[model samples]
Target chain A: MIVHSASIEAINKDIHPGMVVADATATLPALKVYNYKEGVCEKLLAELADWAFRFTPVIAVEAPDRLLMDISGCPHLWGGEEQYLADVVAKLKQRGYHANAAIADTIGAAWAAVCYGRPGQIIPPGGQQTALSSWPPAALRLSPLILDRMHRLGFYKIGSFINMPGTVLRRRFGQQLLTRIGQALGTMPEQLTSVLPAVIFQERLPCLEPIRTRTGIDIALKTLLEALSKRLLKESKGLRKAIFKGYRLDGNIQQIDIGTNRPVRNVAHLLQLFSQKIETIRPALGIELFILEAPVVEDLSAQQESLWTALGDSDANTELSNLLDRIAGKVGSAAIRRYLPAEHYWPERSMKISHSISEKPDTLWRVDRPRPICLLEQPEKIEVTVPVPDYPPMLFIYKGLIHKVKKQTGLNVLNANGGWISKRRSGITTALKTNRVRGIGYSGRVNMTKETLNGIYMDFLHDSYEAV
Target chain B: MGQATEIQENVVERLRQEILAMQGLRVPLENELRDTGLGIINNAFPNQTFPVAATHEFISDNAQNGAASSGFMAALLRILMCKGSCLWVSTRCRIFPPALKAFGISPDQMIFIDARTSKDALWIIEEGLKCQTLAAVVGEVQELGFTESRRLQLAVETSRVTGLIHRYGSLPTNVTCVSRWRITPVASIGEPTIPGVGFPGWNVELLKIRNGKPGRWQVAWNPDGFKVVQQPKVIEHLPARKTG
Candidate 1:
């Protein structure tokens, strides 16, 4: 077994990490040791990074045991840089954590200052060179090999190489050493990858005491929304979507989100939408913080407001969309749909559903002829008894019910493609079109009449044909 | 003492008569019928027009009957839904949305809610009826009892929105609807020169109307509006089949 880490007291007794456990025990018979568990340090670092978000919006976790925060413009809010650094170190100390914090113009310089200079050091802007001159070469955060090489070359202190020419150093030890020197002296730029993207249109409310009631949550949400809406109004923008997140005392977060059909700046309307979904958030433990964030925002100029009332079409469209949102809140978002007319002859394919209400159809519905108010989902098959060639059915049975036809009207012949070919055709021509006949239109009323009427119609047709 | 008592009674009777006259004047103005654009069919109601801000029940015995009822309801909705959208809550929607175009009601003007059960459908319908923003609420359920119908009526009473309940495959019973209707498909009439089917026709039966006489009419939908068809009398001299 090997010793992975040791405390300060163990180090004082000549016990160090990477030493054989047997030897360490022999050196100090009562030395306490623990087996190292993998990934424990990484997990703790991630947790610390999350906690550090309360201090600044930008936080980057440096592995093993470090966190970098860029509190450039944020420190003034906490009463200046010195007090801000002191406040952070004090808070960590209160939490039983030993931490060192430093502020400088560059990341490398700040890291070096925090590691070697003092517990709390504030390096002035453009003062990295002078501040880092007296530190040891190891304080530059170079690799162990580079530090050892520099020590062997009699460059134990950073001041020893502070005045050296870059060209000479580059020729002697390659570009790495020069680059390290440049980075530590603020000549090189460095970038930090934040743990999460900063949300600009966000407001946070931290409670002095944990709140556990629904009314408390409602009040907190209202306050945050008010503040956020004020900021949005000042910027002349509106949010399309907003999320409310509550941080509980037990380290759990509950969030509820709401979306609007248009960019909304009204807090009351937003609160109404949120009220519908706020019950889903289970506040098992007491909540200590509430945050309202708008990740999706749009530029809402004043001119858009004028267009809303200037045109009647736009007014009705907005009203319809608002109604849809309210109904969706009750039923669901998928329950509502809008359709646009499509260019098709088939009844079912004549119109298509639109994804949103704002879309306009290219073609209007065909109103040339009157269509049925309700078309059967599927055409029902009927048994019809008709005369041989071109006469309408005298009797038909549909859905197990027999109907005697007393009168028949317009005869619309549908072609195979579902298009109406002609309204009326001769009996012989209708026989030819029967092969391609897709549908028949037999719309009329049924009445009980004497059989003598049928004979007269037959006689009349015979007389007309003979005269022609 | 008898004279004083008689004087008090006379004053009370005078006040009562004045109030009755005022109520008589207000009733005609407030309960005026809304023209449904159907000529004689509208006259069949109590006020010679269709009922507005009231609940109407339509019974469908089968799929074909359901189709006919929905079509008739769509035609009524075309006139009612001039300013607001409509809510349609159904257990399973069997009516094709595009078919409503024939009645001049666009699919965009209606929002459909597909509920999981008849109970949920009724709840949604009641909630929709309470919303004044909607012009009308249509619920299609297999069965709706008296209590549920009364609750729906009460909701509409407050919101003043019309409610059309299409009951399918259920026997009609006692309910508090303003009126009840049953529509069945009838043999259509077309000109001999016109080969296609003529306009849609229905045998509209007003089974029960509150404070109005019950009647039946043969109505057909024209492009403009509903036209009442005149029934021809029997004449022995005519042929077995009459062609016009």
Candidate 2:
């Protein structure tokens, strides 16, 4: 058995990581051991990275217990670089974690400083050379083979290579050693990638006391909405969708989402939309944090009030949109629909509902022909007696009602060759020939069977029939 | 004294005769009707114009008749929806959106609501009527109670938006609507010289009209507008019928 890691006490007893467990057991017969679970360390590192986000938005997690933070402009918020570094390390230590942190001018330098320098070290800007001069070359995070080769060459300290010419080092150790040295000394640039948060218009509030009451949630929501709306107003933008999330003390997250038909920046209106569903969030064990996120935002121009208070140029449109928003909030977004005409001859295909009301129909409605006021979704089959070929039915029975042929006109035969005809045998032809033939006349081929004719008739019956 | 009283009575009688003649002249002005653009049907209404800010109900007995009524409503809406949007509440809307274009109403100007039930549709209609932003509210309902319609009328009275209710398979009962029209599709006027179908025609019956005469007119929708067609004196039978 090999020791994967060692605690401070174990290390104090001269036990170290990667040492043979049997040998350590021989050295200290009563050593306690634990079985390591796979992926637990990485999971903890990820979690630590998430927690570290509270300090700075820019942070990257290095695998196997290492984190890099670009505390460039963040330290001043904590009163200075020294206090900020000390505070982070102290907080982590209080949480029972043995942490080592170092601040430097560069990522490579900071990484080396944290592993080799003092536990809590702050290397001033442009001081990477002096700070890392005494550290071992292994602190540069070089490969084990390179470290062994350097050790054999009697170049133990980074200062030994700091004076070596770049070309010579490149010839002896290749590009990696030169790159590492250059990066540590701040000569070469390195990219530090941080985790990108999904929501940019998100605000979080950590309560001093756990909030469990409905009023508390409402207050938090109002505060968050005010802050968010202020930010939105400054950006000349508005949010259409908002999600309110509550982090309970027990670690469960409860969330509710509200959507608006139009971009909204009014704090009161947004609060009202959320107020309807805010009670649904159950704060079991009390909520510790409130997060409000605007996932969908759009540009919103400031509304100019009408001076006369009468119907102004845009007042009617604005009022209509506001009313629609209110109704949508109550019934749902799908309840409201706006339709536009399509360039199709078929009734159902003739008009299409638009996603938004602002879209205008490209084509005007064709008024050259008379259309039925109501078109059946499907044509109903009817029994008809045609007095003569190519003439409208004299009598028809539809839904068990018999009607004598009335004065008939406007008869147009719909040929089967029309490409727009539905493939489904909906019996529209027969139904139209019998019931709707008087106004907008239709006749099916006499050679077709009753079954196929029924199908075709049904199809036509379902089609939008023009009223004569 | 008797002679003086007789002279006074003769002067009073002359003044009364003059006033009655002036009233007779004013009758033509008061009886002037508002032309509904459709010249054939203007004489049926009191002022010869469709009632504005009033509720009108259109009943259809069958699907074909329902289609005809829908067309009539669309035609009316084209004139009513001048600048504002309209709300259409229905359980199942069968009127083809493109068909509205035939009546000059754009599909984009209409906002449709698919209510889950007839009751919900009525509620939505009432709410829509209460909103002044909408120019009109159209509901295709199977049932509309007298009280429900009265409430709707009150809403429209305040908002001034026209309410057009297209009720299918509904029982004909007395309601407080300004007008109740039943439209049935009839034979369209045929163009014998052009060898094709003419404009759509409807047998429009004003079943119940408030302060208006109830009459039936054979009206055809033309590109220009609705035209009152004279009854054909002779019936012609053709051997071949053109199918659309």
Candidate 3:
């Protein structure tokens, strides 16, 4: 014996176009073709809200595989409720799913019909028990343990359970089981616990005729942006980057993605950002539908000062970032990188190149230091003859250029706190020390007895002495 | 015989000067350069404020379409609009009207010329550079060939204006532009008030400067604008010691 939940929609007694919705098990998946536990089944159905939209926008997936859709005025698009149910079943089968759908006047009767009654039964407003009594106990979607106990009690079918004293059933299985049965049979009102609904961020442009030209695509995109901008503004959200996908009658998706350095909800600004890239997309075979979706949205308060406004117009930084975004979009973001000073002392390892958005140059990064006029990416080992261990070399060759030190300088370290270091997989740790010894063959080693020799730290300070 | 020797001597002097000037010239350390000007960013840029004559050159290697050139130019145009008016010659990517608006740059201030070929792009850039009334000229091309760079360089010198050729990642060849730069994002500064805050700054290397040493520099980019500072001081070349 199995128990199944039911669903129904009723016009509000007070409001003209308002409706009341009820579901016995809103989180449960519709059916158990696959063995999913009651709790896990509920979770899985909740995640399928996006996919459930195929039936109705007002769809709520009941526990297990059941879904209650308030299709009051929605089914005319599918040519009425019976045809709608058939079409839904066909579509689900195409997507590798099995479902039982029914239409009824009360939520409880609809649940009974879909679970135990035949696939096509339509329960008129007051016919809940007439439709539900003949179904098996298993149709109620109750816990198998409870269903087995009810069977052992000799109440094997839904009609038997209905005929037995409701008081005796309550005294036997706890109140929830009987209440679920009563709710499915229209004896009690059912309540649904709603899940997080799918977020609909798409802006659609349905062209009366196919758009084949770049200009036409531009017009369609502009129309969509205008519409979407208003929605985003109303939501106090801004789009930073969006993908514009064009759908051809042949079902091919042509997508072009555009990005904004800052989140924008202004229609004009959004239009200008995409104008050039739109030419890159050929209408190939023509597009009949256009959809713009912003995958990333930011909380945008229009009152917040624009970066340009905050900087007060004396800065080129905003302009430069916009340029970087454009270049990164075309040549790949990796091609444009800013040099960030690393914590290591090694010349080659002292700097790292990261994507333009990661590290920002601050006032402290500009602190002065004695850096080689021309620092090679990698230090080339050169043969040098020093007068002694602690003396600056009179002459040294680098890249085959021998330059005599006009003024000699010993190591000097600029003391300051390191700026923000981002999380990367493997690199120099920020806590590492830097040791710089500038004299010829300068070597300073810490005592091994101090603790542990994790790694070497070198900091070069400006040491200037006259070369003899 | 005297005239021929004199001509050879003059050529030698010029070549020597060029080499010496190319080597060891450091960009002047002007603390004020980062400031640019006051009231310039907020009032001028979005309103198309800068005059055309104050433009600067932007160099990228590949002039091809969909290369970083247009993006590079757009960013600069965004900056130039901070100060004045701008004309952009787009050879590679199609200009979308909506994207420009999204960036907050006035659509009315921008005139986009689509050049079918690289030759046409260079010619347009050269002409735009010569116009004193425009704030900047961005030439979108696939390759700013040596000859093309020389011609554009001459135009920049004559107009006393900036002309940027948007190129790809390839380093510039023998052709000299006023300044060679690559736009990369600097590490954003983390803020105590705000968790992850980096107002986009650039690690700008003066790859080739007429009067500046080619060293790495960092500049913070804010909506207010770009501000340059010296690159962070780090320990110079030192060998890693082998630990026992």
Model 1 earns a TM-score of 0.56
Which segments of candidate 2 are over 4 A away from where they belong? A1-199, A203-224, A244-256, A268-292, A303-313, A343-350, A363-373, A379-468, B1-48, B173-175, B191-194, B230-244
Query: Candidates ranked by lDDT, best first?
Result: 2, 1, 3
Q: Rate residue B68 of model 2 by lDDT.
A: 71
lDDT of 2 at A439: 27
Per-residue accuracy of model 3 over A1-468 as CA lDDT, tens digit each: 222222222112221222212221233334222222458767766666557676676766765667777667777999877798788778877876556778886566677687677876777777766676777777676788888888887776677767667788778887877777777766778654334455667898888898999879988988889888888878878887889989987888888887765566767656766774787776777899899999898887756424444543322434444443454354344433334545543333454554433244331121232222112222233323345433444444333544343333343322222233232311221111111222322122110000001111111222221111
Q: Estimate each model's TM-score.
A: 0.56, 0.55, 0.39
Candidate 2 structure quality by residue, lDDT tens digits, B1-244:
9999999999986775565333221112232223346664655544456665668899987666776777777767776787478988888876556556666777778898877788878878887888787878899999888899888888877776779998989787656677788887665565656533345667778776654556777777776677778642221232232210
- The Cα local distance difference test for each model comes to 0.70, 0.71, 0.52
Q: True contacts preserved, each candidate?
A: 0.26, 0.49, 0.00
Cα error, candidate 2, residue A277 (Å): 5.5
Among these predicted structures, which one has the highest DockQ? 2
Docking class of predicted structure 1: incorrect
Clash count list over all predictions: 28, 39, 114
